[model samples]
Target: MPKSVVSLWLLVSACTTSPSHSQSWDFELRVVARGLQVPWSVLWGPDGWLWCTERPGRISRIHPETGEKRILLSAIEGVYARGEAGLLGMALHPRFTDSPFVAVAYTVYSGFVELRIVRYRYDASRDTLLDPQILLANIRVGNIHAGCRFLNLPDGTLLLSVGEGGIPALAQDLSSLSGKVLRIHWDGKVPADNPIPGSFVWAWGLRNSQGLALGRGGLIYGSEHGATTDDEINLLQPGRNYGWPSVEGYCDTPPEEQFCRDSNVVEPLYAWTPTVAPCGLAYYDSALTHLPQFRHSLLLATLKGSTLYQLRLSQDGGRIEEVNAYPLGLGRLRDVLVTPDGRVFVSTSNRDGRGAPQPDDDKIVELVPKNQGIEDTEERSLLRLWCQERQLWVEARAPVTVRVITVCGHVLVEWRGLPQQRWSLQSLAAGWYGVIAWDGVRREFSPIVVP
Candidate 1:
């Protein structure tokens, strides 16, 4: 592989240009949950909980109000989480209440890292995920460029975006599953209307598309991470080629123009130079009273840019009229979720080995209208702490034994503490540490950083 291809998987270029317009909506950000390790996906469940997946394959449901996270599965079976490869995307069945099926895509080690899609039964009564069923398996995957975002369409079909698995040649190969948007029934059968007969591929020629969304008139929209320049938001169509290795953004270059004319490659709806590393995408046309200006728009979360981008759609939803950027100061946002009532939530990815992890990094933050009254839900943390002036301030809701441990699970300081306490951190080195609190009945964990 070329050095540039490897750099695309490791390094991300930050976007510095200002958005087309200023932030028009008056919104305040609230921290919903904290101390997550590389949260890869987040879904606003119909049952009113936030379903999230970490890169290490832990499936969790977080209470949107109380910030309590309940782990359903500690580690998915046979998951290979190294670098960018791991349990990536998830989707609840369209009729989740009736079907109760949760579908997930993960990179599993089959000699080499390969991709697999599995379905599990969400057993609410048992408070666990049960009965794993392998829906699709044996797709090629790489450390990076393993595009695996999912969208459960209304017609009871699943749409998955597969990356080229770091091989540029595989993108144009019709027989390969890489670099394609695949359509399959819930049972893993090829959709009847798929362009390729007996094949799950709905569209081809893409390089590491990480986001998928459904727009007006049942149109599919996708966000892709380009190699260096030309991160794209594509209007996906059935049987269309997106021109991955041949063309980066448009048919502007002479060679690309020749390929575009010969291959009939569809250009992107919008492209960003300097590469923003666009990840999760959400379409917002809800009945929410707040942020009416955001109506009929698409919310995009970016890793390198570390900003939530709002692309206002045209009246017919076929064109992007304007692009605006909202920086919440949370670094490397991985996923964005928009609820039916227009509630917006984003998951941070600062701890993903590429960012500077601050104290209590990798949190899920919510965006609310400034006029809306946010209820002050007293956070019940077994142990929580923050740093200020080189002093570590620790707090506890109840009597508990707190242990300050290193990232390798080595205990550095162990003590019994009450509510509101302080410890000097001037002697400690700059690194990551874990603070654990045990109340004899339950245990809680949080991450702290020393600077």
Candidate 2:
């Protein structure tokens, strides 16, 4: 489907006992790009392109507006892709202009199957990624349940989630790299401040975590697949344990309750029975007009259920206040991406040895709100706003007025008719602020948390 606009309602439920509520969202899910061998990861690149990783060892850059794709690299050396194993996660450097680097995680076969994290240099002059630097390698992996997802911290550290590789016992082994979330420095060394000295394991006891995202205050969130039941979305903490083999989700069973008390186990924020196979997780708190219902929520994409699960967070970003489900016709959603503005995108995994594939078997679909395109075209295309170094930065192609307004409608920082600007918020208190940029007639809004 190309440029398909469909009206849909989000199914909201507080709990199993609570009655359901419906919120209408005028979202138009359309094909961004198509025909890929299991597009595992779809990341929005700093260079204004959609970067995608195909399971069969290929990375392509897709034009977001035109849906045109160009292969950056292909037939990655030593990739052993099979059932549930392949090139999976991709992440770009936070400072892409200064330090151009791209990181990827994939399964490789060296005698035995193993998972690996490699960093590639983005050569912008040639528009290609080169110079493969293997950061971490030789982690145990199997044909199935080989988890791989990446999240980059503001402090220049990287977090990766590893599956147990169908070996349930490995989840409890702290010495083993399998079934753990590892935090490592950019140069492949363990961070000095990591929970465990000389160890990259930040958290442990996961069956197959495929989704990783960052929420407010740098809180880490992950989604994992359970064996038969209890697919979970957990708030990951340093050195915390999530009972996998002994306990599926919460400590509902006697044995699991005992294991939890002894093992420092942290229960999942939310768990689902009949396993939805949640693959990709994204944190959304943008104040975009179209998707107001998704603010302060975690967007989860599932494989088996083919649904987008939105878990709304509380005011303090601690609890899940509500759970909402939106069904997209695309089968087996592998990954989801939320842009800085307000766009949401998901990659289809129908061709991944399961589900019924459509004419465009595997595709990256974009969710465009019905009332989109009302903003200034130039502001939408050229404005780049972000937070770094306790400062708010804004760049625009044309002259525009930028304002840093508090949640209570107080304008703190204002810049008029500047192509580029940066304002220090060091004196301001830590909380959420609205960044607004406008050119005379049309305005844009981006909600950001000042940490």
Candidate 3:
């Protein structure tokens, strides 16, 4: 493997430039959770709880406040764990508050090793998963090439990325589920308007696609692991083919051009000459992020390169404005997710038999912006917003108005109080609410999850 070079747009406008351009961001990196056997997928749950899937076949729930870890599922039996094969991806039902369904992708074996997507009912009261049901099954899986990450669309449709499973020919062979992206209903049924009749394949010819993300304006992006030097960031078009064995990155060669023309293959938006092994893709489209420049960018995690790349997209999300890479200095990063509070978290993959693990091996890290006020989080002398308590206790710094807003953008309460006062959230319903404070001109927002 060749070494990859670092690149960033230093001349771009402040919104899209690297952290060096922003003094508003008080960048902070800290471990939230540690000691994991290859954590693969992570996401902030609907209840504002942090959840993670371990590749060794278990799910963990971490306390957002204290970083206390709890094992939701000790082990998913029948999960065939091997080289690059194990319990991999996880996603929550689109309406998780009502549906309460948790889905996971794992390699299962009876007579043969098969990739399966299973759903379970999460019992919040009991803190356990129940009623395991296999939604989709029998997709061929291999040790090395098992791309399995899923993202739920707005309308409850699930988009799943399937790896070529180390077989170059399987990518082009639509008859097999390997090396393709699949789309299906939440109930594991093929959509009535599937690109191919009776098949869940939305697009074919993908090499092991490790990262899948949806962007603004219906734009979908995927990070693909190339054969050697053609790791790609692709614009996933419906029913379009991404030339894999035939064409690596772009149609730079004559044969690749012929293949592109013959198969109607779509070229990647951007690609790396030396494979960076991009694994996770996240789109920042929230005002809570605080950083305006990262609002429309794609945050990607890499394994071999061990970098976090932010690809700033155009307003319409059709074109790329610039690329900025941040070195983790830690080990390989497997997955990344941004919370409703604008704090970004990444899971390390150092213990996956590839990179050298640190003392604790793997961890969940938080990336934050330059913050103001309340310097010491542990000290109660200043102010604090306890999500679980649904109270903002202040220590009288300045006269500020506290506004409690819902996730749906509705203001529930607005109370003007002194710094050393308490604002009770008794008026707001039980749910996660966004609370913002404004002192004349300066504004700060925090997240609160009501029990």
C-alpha local distance difference test of each model? 0.80, 0.80, 0.76
* Worst lDDT 10-window in candidate 1: 2-11
- Compose the digit string of candidate 3's lDDT tens values, residues 1-451: 1111111111122212224312222354556676788889998988777889999898988865567888889999888988889999899998988899988899977676789999999998889898999998998878888889988887789998989878899899978889999998878899988788999999999989878888877789999998779989999987899998899999989999999999999999889877778998988884555555577889899986456788888878877778876654455899988766666888989888887665665878777443332233333222354323434333334587776665433567777888667755555555545555657533444444444
Any runs in candidate 2 off by more than 4 Å, and if so which? 1-22, 371-451
Give the C-alpha miss distance for residue 303 in model 3, angstroms.
Answer: 0.5
TM-score of each: 0.79, 0.79, 0.77
lDDT per residue for candidate 1 within 226-297, as digits (tens), equals 998999999999999999999999889999999999998999989999788899999998455656767889
lDDT per residue (tens digit) for residues 1-451 in model 2:
2343322322222211212522354565656786787999999988788999999999999988778898899779889899999999988888889889899999988887899999999887787889999999999989998989999998989899999999999998989999999999778999998888999999999999999999988888999999889999999999999998899989998999999999999999989987788999998875655467788889999986457888999877778889976656456899999888767889989888877665656888787765565322332443565455536555665678776766444568887766665445456576645555667633445445455
**lDDT for position 413 in model 1:** 82
Top-down lDDT ranking: 1, 2, 3
Error of 2 at 134 (Å): 0.8
